[model samples]
Target: MKSKMLTVLFMFFTMYSGFSQDFQGKATYESKTQVNMDFGNRQIPEDRKKEIMERMKKANEKTYELVFNAKESLYEEDEKLEQPGGNSGRGRGFRAMGSAGGDLYKNIEDGRYLIKNELFGKIFLIEDDLEKLDWKLESDTKQIGKYTAYKAVAVKTVKRPNMQALFRRRNTDGKDGEGTKEKKVEEFIEKEVEIVAWYTPEIPINQGPADYWGLPGLILAVSDDVTTIVCSKITLNPKEKIEIKAPKKGKKVTQAEYDEISREKMKEMRENFRGGRGGGRGGARF
Candidate 1:
């Protein structure tokens, strides 16, 4: 048994060594996100609701590509051109469409990652240590296209805005104190989500979409409850050289810093909408 184990280790090292010399690939992926919107108690016409849902669907559908080698990778959403004289016709519901964050560049050897985020018409470059999820390996196996894949699962905690809490109003009775008559707005709250990934040992590279990596093999599919990104096409060891470099534009910040910035901006926007002239004269009064 010890001799067999040694043989396995030898083969693993041999394969990884070959990767350093001649291993590069490009992968195309399709990303889909589920949209859920609540219009509160406002009685909206059925026609308007249908129009909102359609626009939300279009914004959620996206395509991306990942170019990678043994040491690094670059993943970016493919830019889609708008049709001539086309109007996006986005509304408040459009925000429910969600975003994939932005372009990501990872250097596995250096344990580094850089992400470009566009929030509130501002660009931020987040540079930080690569996010390493504590993935639990499963014995399950499946065939995805021509590759045999294995399963892994991870739990991640993210801070999300409490949208409902933003609209909370305090009761103003005849006898009311300061604390009893005002609503406390919660800017953000923490939520946990599960990530399931399928990877193939055939590629022998530790890489995946977005901030997902640290696996023993190449990830072909990754899904959370609301979003899923699946590999549609993969080209390994192409004849032409591929470049895997970091994104170099935007104001630099850390992941935590960027998250704070995003939250503040979102809160400001919400407050503005609640008080603007277009928001019905004296904002929304409950």
Candidate 2:
């Protein structure tokens, strides 16, 4: 038994050592977030609710590509052509509420990350140390494609927009405009949610899509409370090497600072919406 164990360890070490030299890989991910179409206490026609849900579904589903080496990775969304006559403005608003659309560069060896985020027509380079999650590795295993995957779970506290408030119908009776203003103060709130990730040792790279890393292998699938990001395809050591570089074209700020900026912007938009200065003739759509 000891000899067999030694042989397994030797093979793992050999594979890792081979990859450590000049390994580069590209992974494509499909991300989708489940939208709660429930508008609390809002009386809307069923047809209109269906239309809003469809728009939200389109905005929530996205594709991303991650280019990685031994210690560094760059994850960015795969661009798609906008459909003609599509509501681009409403789509953008929903996307802004969902996830950060940016070039995310992570350096696991150095414990740092840099994200080039464009929010509200302004660009920001969010530079900060990676927030390490206390992952509890599980013995569960499953097959993802040809690779065997192990599961890990963690609980994370994240700030999320109050979707109910955002979608709630405002009293147009002009009796409680002040109350609306006060409610906008809690546009975002912190909530704790569980994250589940499945990593495969076959790739033997401590990398994953987005800001996830520090596993024994490459992550094949990860899901949080609302969103699930899964690797659809992976290419290892392609003929053309992909460059993983941190983006440089933005005003630098820490993650906390950027969050504050985003929150303030959302607050301002909410105020504008309350004051009937938000959207076009139909008022804010979804």
TM-score of each: 0.81, 0.85
Worst 10-residue stretch by lDDT in candidate 1? 89-98
Model 1 quality (TM-score): 0.81
Quick one: best lDDT, which candidate? 2
Report the Cα lDDT for candidate 2. 0.76
Error of 1 at 166 (Å): 7.4
Please list the C-alpha lDDT of all candidates, in the order they appear.
0.71, 0.76
Off by over 4 Å in 1: 1-14, 85-100, 161-185, 276-286
Residue 213, model 1, lDDT: 92
Q: Return the number of clashes found in candidate 1.
A: 0
What does candidate 2's lDDT look like per residue over 156-274, in tens digits? 88888766656444666643434543233376878899999998767878889878887778999999988899888999999997888889989999988878777766666655655
User: Which portions of model 2 show Cα errors greater than 4 Å?
Assistant: 1-14, 37-43, 87-91, 94-99, 169-185, 279-286
> What would the per-residue lDDT of candidate 1 be over residues 199-251, giving only the tens digit for each residue?
87678788998778987778999998778999989999889899777888899
